[model samples]
Target chain A: MKISEIGEFGFIDEIKDNTLFNPDPVVIGIGDDGALYKTTQGMEQIAVIDTMVENSHFIIGRTGEWYDVGYKAVASNLSDIAAMGGIPTHIVLSTAFRPDMDVDDVIALYKGIKDICRTYKVNILGGDTVTSQEGAVITVAAFGEIEAGKALLRSGAQAGDVVAVSHTIGNSGAGLDVMLHGADGYDELKKAHRFPEPQIALGRLLVKHHCHSLNDISDGLASEANEIAKASGVRLVLQYEDLPISEELQRWAAASGTQAGKFVFTGGEDYELVFTMSSADFAQLQAEFPAVTTIGTVEAGPAEVVLCQGGKRELLPAAGWTHF
Target chain B: MKISEIGEFGFIDEIKDNTLFNPDPVVIGIGDDGALYKTTQGMEQIAVIDTMVENSHFIIGRTGEWYDVGYKAVASNLSDIAAMGGIPTHIVLSTAFRPDMDVDDVIALYKGIKDICRTYKVNILGGDTVTSQEGAVITVAAFGEIEAGKALLRSGAQAGDVVAVSHTIGNSGAGLDVMLHGADGYDELKKAHRFPEPQIALGRLLVKHHCHSLNDISDGLASEANEIAKASGVRLVLQYEDLPISEELQRWAAASGTQAGKFVFTGGEDYELVFTMSSADFAQLQAEFPAVTTIGTVEAGPAEVVLCQGGKRELLPAAGWTHF
Candidate 1:
């Protein structure tokens, strides 16, 4: 069987079962945003690695700049830590590129990385630089820390838990469309696609408020919700009208003859937090984070997601971006 | 300027100058096999990442099995921690490959990783698998731990220190030649190339023996020796006759009409350790590890390495493998 038959998540599931040889230090091993391992008496270290291949993740010169490529690479890894409600502390970066690549472009890439590291107070550790046969490949391995038992996992949602998102969804997806199709007026969408900010502060706040489940919107809300549902062995019911789609994305979708809800559900790389919590906790959190919008609720049922519109319900397929 | 103009080490030098945004936790940052950072009051964490591109590092199915590729990837990262005299505990693996690759082959790759992780008692934490447009790329980020002050560094060598290596050198280089040229009657050399072992035990022993500077022979003996000399700000005089050369490698080199010293000096990926220590400590370590061989001595002079043979001395240039 080809790996494409299994898909990315299926490939992960295939390798995830027998990975921990010495399981003593591992609090949470494979199949999470990051691996959580016991470090000190009351602290756990989270390690996550993400790789962006040329053309697969971004077009260096065309997407925005080499700086933007570097920025997005670090942002995506930081988002994983945010999904785990952890404080990112350090990162090691590996870049594989052609020898003929300009040194100034590489320096610009590092400048983007350095700026983000400074903003997050993350130290740049050591990494490898090697020659690639073709396009460049950048991999960042990020390390973070969280208090013991304070991590928000994908498997903690309970029936009646309210599902919410930290920011308006689909802006990035519309931004990508704008960049690709040359839609003249959507600077907000273009910037959203170019430079995403990981929701670290919101993640910490959710964990403090005892959020039940959390995921980062790297693979879109539909796929992320399905992951939470499967991991938690529950059903998610998302209200179609309740999804927080941005005005710019909606307007762009209307002008382009596309569905805004499609972007909200299946367009990935938003870098926003999607989480579940008790209704009371959601209410308390909404006051502190006014932009947080309720989109769904957890239910005790088969592991799947459903989208409800007006008076009809339909299954939400996990059609989010899969590499394979 | 193109990165190739400055070369791999030059590119590293370019990025090494300013990386640490938060300097408190960092004990050592760039320009080393691994980054060492303070994790707890008395413990430091060692993190290293290595990437292997398809044609650059290994050609799948051409250079042994897919298993060998996976094993070597993890082995290379583990070797970095070994160079730091740390106990490797965990690793995160990332792979970018064509989606049409066989699932069984990927499983075989993971089996190789699993086998090595079990042998070292290191846990497979988490990783990212993505689609690459071209040939496969594998990256491994390894983490290890060492006592606060017991970690060996490349800058600790002093004048009068003895330089030694844990095992005979150039076997892997010979093995690569055997594989590439289809040379017969050298199974040992082939095995050395296919499955190079990290010198973790020897590294631990060296640290216990208060060994000073240390490096793994991934970029040949001359390059590693030069790194030690430069980092420690001392001159090293290597006795050419005392350099350990395997009998098989020597015989093979003779049969192939190639000088065996060429491989000994510039053949990389050996994974054995080269280290320095006070003469007294070297004597003590030799008693415990009889295979260890003294090949050189540190001298008070400019940071450089000299090859001495038959009362003649010549400068040794770092003509090891550069990715470019």
Candidate 2:
């Protein structure tokens, strides 16, 4: 039938009826503001989004490593699902490029994606590729499933929970400084900045042991701690002396005369997990990995984050990452 | 312990162990390239992606209506899920804009998204918003579920199956012509161009009834027919006289001295569904909507699409849409 004969609404109804399922998974279908779905039994879903733009997110020429761009873009999203203590199954990617974008960069980018997908054994399924006016824009959406009622949240922290981080915090930050300043020889820090790994496995361990709360440190530690504090409605007191700083990061900071401690507190894009758990859970985790630090403690107080040592008290700078 | 003290690999190890889910929905965790997930029983996942760019995809000023841009962006993705005979559940959007983008325009753009999400009952789970160097880039990743055994692939057509379309064609192409020419009074065609609804219901019904191969008419019918023919390893013989063309499209074409038939066949972005089913299924679908025309048939010929009526036969135009 011609859609025009029945008008727009009639045409829409035809479209709607064509999608009806027998033993449907639909809780609600067309004619609403959103589609409703029946959830799978025994599973909760975890999702993550990552965005990459030309010039702003990554350089296209000279300093741009197109392969790493693709690798890290996918990693960033996967990390979020990992942060939530969930397993990822499917990923969708969207790429927008100007008409003039080199074909080689596109191939390299897809290679990076394929490499990661093969490693994770996740399917690409489908995605969008369109023409942009100028530079390229890439966004990846990653999805995973987890045990229902068990996916970790940032609001699960309690007073007396040991504030712990999965790994040292300042390497990525230091790496970024090295890159921006065009310095040399901190190859470890540079790699950390370009290809920081997300703590997916560590996240699952925390969930398995009934850890109180979990978060990925995509932003700096200070901002991440603030998020956990606000979400859980508690205060956090971290030890500056206990802040995780890599040897390479400390060396780079000393050579550059940059404050290594502040870098741990303020840098961004680390893609690590900053979490809290009971000392017992922490101890169990420590048995497996002795370097997991009990850096602070959750406390019953206003929703704020502070750092101190040597019998002094001070507020940590709100070192939130703001991308432009 | 500080991540730096343990080094990069050690930090990654800690991250990996932490995400390891006990009773893991995580079939695979960190150290892999992508995360692996276990599936929900009896269901298959369907995903779709839509990308909108500045200048090329939509005009940012003058003729541009930000609200419609937002609405159409979301609708386009939903339409793809519908095309696959799946029930859409979650949608994630990633938008890149410049620092100078007006706050009100952003509000209006989101309102457009809000309007459609409200209509569809879709929750905007979460997405990434980042700054761009130039114009706005919005990409949506939409997810849906279908009965695993029942997903309708593009390779299911068979000889003698009757070909059918869910609605009339050509209106959207005509609408675009009108908009580009700045002509007035063809609001229906214009609306068809600006806000074509996705055919979710029709897709579901097709799957439930066990139809053969199916395809959405995003490109012109000619290209879609070619896709089906190529995928299914069969040939399509369409009756040119039987093509569904709306009155508005006809009027616009007549006024412009454009062949309405060519518009129905060669112009793209119609967002209709074209499929082949048994005569029995066609009869069943037709009983509800008499306008469902048997415009063509499938046959054992070279894998190509031909248009014929009475004594005339010609190869269909290769006019599919292409993106860079």
Candidate 3:
């Protein structure tokens, strides 16, 4: 039947009439942007977003990594909450699939997703699935909650706050470059491209330590530092020599003739934490754990990210990754 | 860099480490199925589902009706709420597209969806978009709320209750058959295929007057009635002569040499309301609205949906649409 005949309102009414709704706490169902459920008093809520596309996100023949695709899809959203200091709980998956796509592929996708959910003790709960003349699409809305006073934001940096990174950078981006160019380091670079990790435990630790402010280095360190600067309303001075680069990434970059420095600074999709803390705390943290380094400090004036060499400060160029 | 190399846990850890979390409410994130959010003593939650597909759900060539396809996508979901006797409020769209699908087509789809949302006082809150190698896919998750104790279900039927139908039936199914056959009477049947009206207000009225059991007729009257009967655990005896068939539908069916009875009984996608209520209340409703008919009666004994003809009761044949 023509959808217009039912009209939008009419169609909604029909679906509600057809389905059964549980009636414990919710007063209404099937007529709002988000289903409403009862909650306890003084509780905070968590929210996360993730998107998936067909060809760009997954290529059938070329991607023998379907499992990775499914795993990454969920993990990406969960990372968003971890950054917020919230515990992961329930997820809603919204998806569309073409008729031609084998049901098995979908089964594999869900299997991977379910695996992660089971490991983490999270509920699959509910979601919507539809057919599309276009390709397959997946969007997940994950919910989490944190203590009332401890949710983190991106704007809490202070001057003399030590900058710490969770891991080496540029691997994912370099991996992508290698994959596209068919470079010599096929296996290593492909691995980086397919499976970059998010550091949840460290984020929780930072929250526990009352670290200044932080954000994931999605676009690149240069861009992420700029974000911290903008949010904290402070200037950041970086020492390029202090930046960490993995040995594998350095070898790949060297053989490919791609500057490891540029990759480290501008390459994104690292999914690593970039955070700030006071100088005193930096010393204390260093005394306790040697891996953390003071890469930069927050300054009071001139909101900018500057690279300090010897005694001179050079402005860092901005080159954020573009999706489209 | 293969995806497994990064590993699910590792990838999530990286994402979390790179993010800044507020310690106020969370123990952790990034590694769980769902995000944990703070709870409250009382909160209202709702859930709704919608689906869309490519060829079967939409058209692509000269024969294809893209605009109508978009319209139907949203209409179907909206109809769900209309049947539930509630008002729709929010929608989350999940879409998948092939590599070749035009960006403009995607935009048009959203425009159609947005148009409906605007009319229904619903908001397009958040959704995920992804790519697929096959065709396009779209799913919408809509949510709504109503006053406590006002939501409707399909398990409230009682014997001696009257059966009522909203508007006309068999139009959409006949319309589709007409279009598929490449027959003449294009306009009337096409309207049925392109524009369906969901009976929202009538459903609300049914709820208001305390409907015993209710459901929308998507898989034809007989099929949906069967659902009501099954769910309510009762037998239903329908009067064949009382089946509502539009004059136009009759003409179209006659001209096409299709049985009107079959169209009314077995054809699906009607989106009409089929409800049962106490005889006294049904009589009052029928008095107020003369168009409604007592097409069926709930009975004790084995759960069966039978049609009565010349004092003889025969089982209704199973003939309806199946999504899978």
The TM-score obtained by chain A of candidate 3 when compared with the true chain A: 0.80
Give the candidate order by descending DockQ: 3, 1, 2
Mind giving the per-residue lDDT tens digits that candidate 1 earns over A216-241? 99877888888898889999998988
Query: Highest DockQ, which number?
Result: 3
**Candidate closer to the true structure by lDDT (higher is better), 2 or 3:** 2
Tens digits of per-residue lDDT, candidate 3, A1-324, equal 433344434433432331222234333333332344543345566656566776676554454355666666777777666666566655567666554666456656666666665555444445555555565566776655566767766678888777777777777777777766656555655665566565576667777778788777766888878877877888888887788877878888788887776677777667777889877766665565566666877788777888876676787755532211
TM-score of chain A of 1: 0.86
Q: Which portions of model 1 miss their true places by more than 4 Å? A: A1-41, A320-324, B1-41, B320-324
Q: Per-residue CA lDDT of candidate 3, range B158-178, in tens? A: 888777788667888788877
Cα miss at A318, model 1 (Å)? 1.7
**Candidate 2 local lDDT, A169-282, one digit each (tens):** 878778877877778678887787677776777877887888888878777888789878888999989987887788898898789987777678777778888889999989
Per-model root-mean-square deviation over C-alphas: 11.5, 10.6, 9.6
Relative to the unseen true structure, what is the C-alpha lDDT of residue A123 in candidate 1, on a scale of 0 to 100?
A: 61
Native contacts, share recovered per candidate: 0.44, 0.40, 0.45
Runs in model 2 deviating more than 4 A are A1-41, A61-64, A320-324, B1-41, B60-64, B320-324
lDDT for each residue of candidate 2 in B1-324, tens digit (9 for 90 to 100): 322245434433432222221333433333222233444667766666778887776675423488878888888777777776876655667777676676566666777776776676555555667878778888887766677667666678999998888888877777878887788788888787677777778878888667788877766888778878887889898887788888888898889988787678766667778889999988887776565677899999888888886677877754632210
